[model samples]
Target: MKHSGKVPDFQDFVECVEKANSGKINTKVLSIGDLFAWKDCTSKQNLKCRGEVPYARDMVKLTAERGITYLLYSTKYDEPCSKVLNFLQAMLMKNFPLP
Candidate 1:
């Protein structure tokens, strides 16, 4: 994602999951676009810019507690909070697989 500057086609992945389930299941994408927007807005206000300023960790924590699988398509891996976010679990370090 850092090298390509592109988000993956999340819809295609959802479709594949639906097909694999014989169209019996549906998937929801909790996009990080809104999170990025919030971070930008907070920056404009000169708020506290801690490593966890965007609080992606909080969202991930909720998902973990709820047993929800998180498939993140992030443009940043070298970010300050990347390590703190525990990327070792499901983080895809490679660029987004966009054709």
Candidate 2:
């Protein structure tokens, strides 16, 4: 998987999920983004930030690829999930309700 830091590229993630769904591989769980800690994207000093939101075009592609499900986990309302959602909404206004 192509990755920057610990976060894998969103397109790569979609591809792996598709592969697993097609029975090409047996993957039960796939994790993306940060699971250990949250980093602010607006901060210029957080060079170790792991919250790289998927690209707008990549997010659109993910929606088009059926059979993929995702869950959001967060401890705070104004956290990484919100940032991710905001980024997705800004990128894919028409495809907000990802199938």
Cα lDDT tens digits for candidate 2, 1-99: 333234367776656565553557754444554344433323232322446544445332222224322323343444443222232222234443421
The candidate that achieves the highest TM-score relative to the unseen native structure: 1
List candidate 2 stretches off by more than 4 Å: 1-7, 23-99
Q: TM-score, each model?
A: 0.25, 0.17
What are the Cα lDDT values of the candidates? Answer: 0.39, 0.39
What does the lDDT come to for candidate 2? Answer: 0.39
Name every residue pair that clashes in candidate 2. Answer: none
CA deviation > 4 Å runs, candidate 1: 1-9, 33-99
